[model samples]
Target chain A: MSDSSSSFISNQVSDISPVQSSTTQSQRRGSSADQDDVILSIRSLCKSYFDAEILQDINLEINSGDFLVLVGPSGCGKSTLLSCIGGLTDVTSGEIFCRGKNITQLDPAKRDIAMVFQSYALFPNMTVAQNIGFGLEVRKVPAAERKQKIQQVAEILHLQPLLDRTPAQLSGGQRQRVAMGRALVRDPTLFLFDEPLSNLDAKLRLSMRTEIKHLHQRLGGTMVYVTHDQVEAMTLASKIMVLNQGRIQQFGSPEEVYKRPANTFVAEFMGSPAMNLIRAKVIVEAGAVKIQIHREDRAPLVFIEQAATDALRAFNNQSVIIGLRPESISDVAARDPQRSHSAECRIEYIEGIGSDVYATLKLGGSDVISRLHGDSNVSAGDRQQLHFDLSNISYFDPSSQLRI
Target chain B: MHSTIKRPRHLSCLLYASLTLLAFFVLAPVLWLLLMSLSSPTDLTKVPLQWIPSQWDFSRYALLLDWQNGSGKRFLAAMLNSLIIATSASFIALVAGVLAAYAFSRRNASMLLMFAFLATIMMPPITYILPLYSAFSELGILNTKVSLIICYSAMLIPFAIWLMKTNIDVLPEEIEHAAMIEGAGTIYTLRKVVLPIILPAIGATAMLSFLTAWDEFFYALIFSSDLSAKTIPVAIADFSAGRVTDFGVIASVGVLASVPPVLIALFFQRFIVSGLVGGSVKG
Candidate 1:
């Protein structure tokens, strides 16, 4: 059983080599030369509300034509930062550069970005055509050209038939489309969206999400989107910036952020049925590292691999945490592998979700979850043996919650 | 089976009884006023307060229109003067209040200054009436329509600004941001977006301003000494204090004085309802 488990650890370590190399290469490429591809650069951004600092030292560079999403829990300053970029709010101190020009004091209209608000922000009194044409009219676009652009954008959004109706006369979904059309008609340099689908029902939000994806693909415009929904961030963003307490916790692609979270917060926040965290103490004996797990009247010491040992060497003889995603653990009785790490657990509950089943079990005085193949005979109050896929385990410093 | 059908029949009987009583309570005074306006003046003093008169007397309303009803009072002139004063004062006050309200709503003014201006609204006109009258006399504006307009408008501006500022405060700031990003400046956004959306509140506030001008007694009594500058209220008050004490004429004048406001309230009743509730709540 230990032979196959060791091979799995070796395989995961081998996979990390290529990922690390590519990341370093990209990092080098960014630092070696000042890439003119940065469409907007925000540096040293700070905001305070009557002495309470909401955002501090926020630095971000948005590349041309990239769809970037800022995601965080509530009150994390994601919306505040977006408003700063749009020039709708005053930053305490910062430099906002657009196309190599400092525009920190520029008004929102002069910043050359259009924002679609969560409430849709459509003029309830105006017809669809007038709302679409309003920006152009304000910019002194010729009436003929305004008509042409309005017609074109209306056709693209399939809003031609509804152009004569006011916003209140339209359904929630239709109002959303009009809001999108209002932003699209301007063809501004940067497009900002603040949870644009949040007001719609579940079905409509899904459809609009797909539509927004299609629009981004078709236009290839630079976008900066904000949402508290991780799924929206995962599916739509080319790059995701996770924020916590007004600071950037992690910034990477969806795959990097999910699999190799910088800390425990990212792991727990990005997944449904959140990751299970168990406390363990680390000890090294005979130049080999092992984690001690204590159960009631029983104790099992599991040896850590060399790679994980190296990562945890700084916390020698200190308590550490083991995080295991629900999918990483399974019922060993269901699948007999060539090798596996087995543990005796007492089944606490079983929840069936059609394609797969989730069972909660007690292991070493803590409750852990395992997702296994369909229809297990396990019920509550039954003793069972569960398998832990050690390859998917994560180690974190127990005090700081930082990934080891 | 028959009693089941008859149950609703019993309910409808009580419903009709209550509704008829309610309608009578509401319509009795209005119907009596209309009938009295058509009766001769001499029959008004007769016993039993005649419900209907034998002859029609349309001459009283004609005399009201002709600007002559003896005792040297000019009703037509007074009505015209009231119209000019109320319309001009209300319109000017509305424009100034809207602009100032926008500033206050945006928090662009100093808090001290805002509170000071708001404090003016709580000061009663009776507190400043003598000083205001003396100032008007010194400025040579006494007994002119402009004097009344300036006085009424000054009195109304503080409350109007307060009302509008509260209304504008409740509107979502995002809509204004959207408009600004659409390339609209302050005036354009106000005229195109903000004004139309809050038109109901605007209509309601305008009615309030007009009503204040129409019903004001102290300012009109102090300022207007001649027949040419007197408003409807002062004219009606003067007519009631005369030697004869014509009850019919007083009733006719009372009905006439209420016509414009009642008609306006009926025409814009929907706006009034929305404005009253909307300004106080979501706006």
Candidate 2:
């Protein structure tokens, strides 16, 4: 059943134009060199609980050896999408392809996938070794191989010394490792992790995140991890799928998603302290395109960026949201005036974060934050000249929220 | 500070005096029964109200044990019958109740089935006595151990399920899901994951079931007409009502009947308290 659907998608891939085909081929090669071949393809997935839609049409493809992350806000459907792939949840309408076959209707066990839950659901009655061997035992793997494999997995997870200990005897982090080892020994086609480190302390979470990345690289197994933590998504995923309100906001390589967000939501959702969004209106005057930003209690200003102007030619007089990362804005007082784009604003609050300073400035009828070096002279309630890099600004249509 | 603390101490003495008087009012009848069991048979109805036995005779205990002289039944045999009935009934009830509790805990079973079972506990046990008695008699099990076990198990399952269901609900569903993802089926997860966490509640339920079986007197008296099925409680009651009541033997049997439950509590006191508290406090 899955074979037919996979063949159908492959057939679809074969019918594209040469330009698209080559681009896709290059893209595939880029991922294939790192990850295994394609193992799971989620197409047009939609789910609604009762009548409230929790996931919209989600389209994602998981290759054989890739660390894919589904990340978003609490109710953005990232966990729902991950659960759908693992068959822990049912999709309202979609097809899930596993190993070149359709497995949307298959039970979780039959899907041949291993998942580590966020809670690290170790069977409290079983020892660490027993928990690790449970999956293999269920599949009727011979007892000897199961034992040997469990031992090997325990060693890999550094749980060999604790093999005789039940989950009740272990700490939270130890139990988490046992949960991972349980999935690890399965050696299945895919691994699903649902915020596995969320229950750990900050130090352990960082270490575990590094370990997961290393393990993925070493095994080169196909993995789909779900987390709301952006740092984990950035560090662990080769491809990140950003979701918002049951819809995919953006799906691309981590760098691509970070550098070229598809919309304001993706841009703001990905960065720490978030990207500052300013409301502005595009205007055309004397055959020149510019933006007029009006801030209450401040003088109005006109700004022009050639790229933004050209891209928004037909969007004159339309309100647009401007996206700027904190680091892209700096204090004009310290930075070379000739090397920076300048804007005038009142300083609202200044926060120092070790190596840099973040000053929240009122500008363009909204608040924009600037990241300055450690010696920045800006202080709270002080009028300041802030410089925003024109080349790094992202413009989004106010209504559609699509990037221009 | 000492003087301030003494004010509550004085108040407590007054409260203690009143509560002690109330306790004596409630316990006076029990004290009278104890005195009656120790006094001579003629002294039982004496108008002088003899609180102490003058002869200090132990012949009643000997006669009650012989049954040939007391109630035409053996105390040892009745004691054995009670043990078998209570243990078997509680054990069977636990098995059935755990299975049904697990089913109700995980799935959304019909309200009608749950309520129908619960309704049995709400009605007095005598409400079903005639039908149950006729069925047992027709099946030749009216005075058998099997009849008591089946009846006790049926009577206790509703309350057990209700108690266990509450404990099971507080457990995170994720634990079961994780077990399932790890390849455990429903039964394996229940036995390995769910059971251990709720062990306290299971123990508490067993204790409650055993107590219910031990304290039951109506069914034992109505159904058993011979030594083979008569339990300790029935035998004790019968001996006390005879033409010559043996007070010492009744007290000894009463002490014996109380031993098992007291031992069970002593051995599992921690589990019983923890389980009951865990269920109530959700900690």
Candidate 3:
């Protein structure tokens, strides 16, 4: 309740850290934690429609209560993958297991999975209560119990006032809530959401996004969500599955997928004001590895990166692409001093959004964006010393376009 | 492409004028029929025709409806027969057509077969009349309501299938997909979900098929010989078949026969507009 207790808790944590760390490491090594916690598993899952392959070898293992988000650009098979998991679509080849039971060919009803569709797909004719209870009703749940379950879900979603209204009579956000309530009433083994908030306006989408995140946190339900919005994927997911061209580019925690992307596509697709990738030559000089950025009318911008040195060492005197997030490159005042490097880049353009300014600069023959604080009023053609957070840098092989 | 600009005033006036003229052209025949039904026998033979009858002789309607009168009993029997045949045929067609349409629209059934069905039903009835007549005769259903109902159902089923399919096609498959995934069986989903949404189409189809059967003259004329199964169209023809025909009675019968169809059209006009437009969900 007060600073003393907060300090005491911190002090207590520090005092026990060494002993706890030792025991936890051994426990982790001894126990097969992941194997027992898996709620859903897909092995060599493939889906095709007539002649075209929609998904290919989508293998995934989801932990219980984890919010797994499948994200990509349009038609990237993320939704298809979610549908495959929900048993809404047939898989061409491979096996799907839920809680260690093979349910690859089970009917969607028989498989205890519920889904909220992109269109909300709320029954247009039924009241919100009826729509929420339709699944239970179909399962032949007792009427009074169905009503109670509907009441509980309605209260959770703040849909009690709208329980009597048909979908056509409800707002988009209200309809989305009703769609979710329908799924929530089942309390199924897994929950699926196929771009549930994509239909709402931007403001509503943001609020609903927060609501969904909060819902998952409060309920601790394992959810597999599909969205084309990377921000949604980054913000809501316990683990993010990045898909491109019907193949998973990477699947990891949001930070892991962002900071250490598996490949170029995941790096570029995962961030807004995308990570700047520039082709540069790696050179070793006097037992030190330095990355050189060559320009036409100026000396090469050279900086020594702290991370990725061993990988960079293998490419001495050879080309490799360096990836840096926009926020990683900022005004010189933002330098961390520990691993930050300074670069003199000519600002090509600038866009201001009240809180910050994004200045586009030509760096190493590539257009790179540097996110600057709003007060740093640098204009185009002005050469500025931008600080790069070298600790957050990534190196990719230029030939394969994979993180080195 | 909705325009804010209003049309030219003169053009709108001309359009309204033409609409009114079209309405007059259509309603004038029905108006004439009503006037003739009220005119006396003497009023009909006056060489210079009176637009309005000098006397309103409503006895013709009474006589046609009288149970004791031979002509009235025949007319009443025909009306009953027409009612039974139209209702039965359209009902059977609706039940069978909705199932076929649900299959064609929802189950990825071959649409080519539906088109083929349409093509076969589109052929002139005369092409099959000889075989139909022989079949009915052989089955001992000739001169019966069953014969006409059978023929009318065959004629109207294609129309029912086409209308129902288009309306069902307009429904998003996601709703059914959601239902199926949520544990609703196929039949339950159709009864609870699809049926309610496509009810307008059902109404329109039923009304249209009923009208189609009600208007059938050739089939009824050939199949029904007398009071046992004679329909309104056959009765109207018989009213003018012999010498000394009572034109007032024929006019009255014509006016009454048109009543059910006009009322049905009025009730179903809104549904028809929507059902037809619903098929354009694609683009």
Best by DockQ: 1
lDDT of 3 by residue, A29-66 (tens): 43333423778989878899999989876777776777
The predictions' CA RMSDs to the true structure, in order, are 6.5, 5.7, 7.8
Single-chain TM-score of chain A, each candidate: 0.85, 0.87, 0.90
TM-score for each predicted model, relative to the true structure = 0.87, 0.84, 0.91
Location of the lowest summed lDDT over 10 successive residues in candidate 2 chain B: B274-283
- Model 1, A255-323: lDDT tens per residue? 766776666787788866677877777888777677776665345636454455566866678888887
Of the two candidates 1 and 2, the one with more favorable lDDT, higher being better, is 1
Candidate 3: regions farther than 4 A off:
A1-36, A309-311, A332-336, B1-13, B270-283
> What root-mean-square deviation over C-alphas does model 1 reach?
6.5
Candidates in order have lDDT scores of 0.78, 0.78, 0.85
CAPRI-style quality class for the chain A–B interface of candidate 1? acceptable
Question: Clashes in model 1: which pairs?
Answer: none
lDDT of 2 by residue, B1-283 (tens): 2554455777889999999999999888766655655667666556785667776655555655574553425777887888898888888888888888878878777768878889999998899899999999999998887888888888888988888888888887777776676666778778877887788878888888888988889988888888888888887787678786656556656755677888987767887776555432110
Candidate 2 residue A95 C-alpha distance from true site, Å: 2.8
In angstroms, how far off is A211's CA in candidate 2? 2.4
Better of 1 and 2 by DockQ: 1
Best by lDDT: 3
Clashing pairs in 2: A2-A101, A2-A102, A3-A101, A36-A65, A37-A64
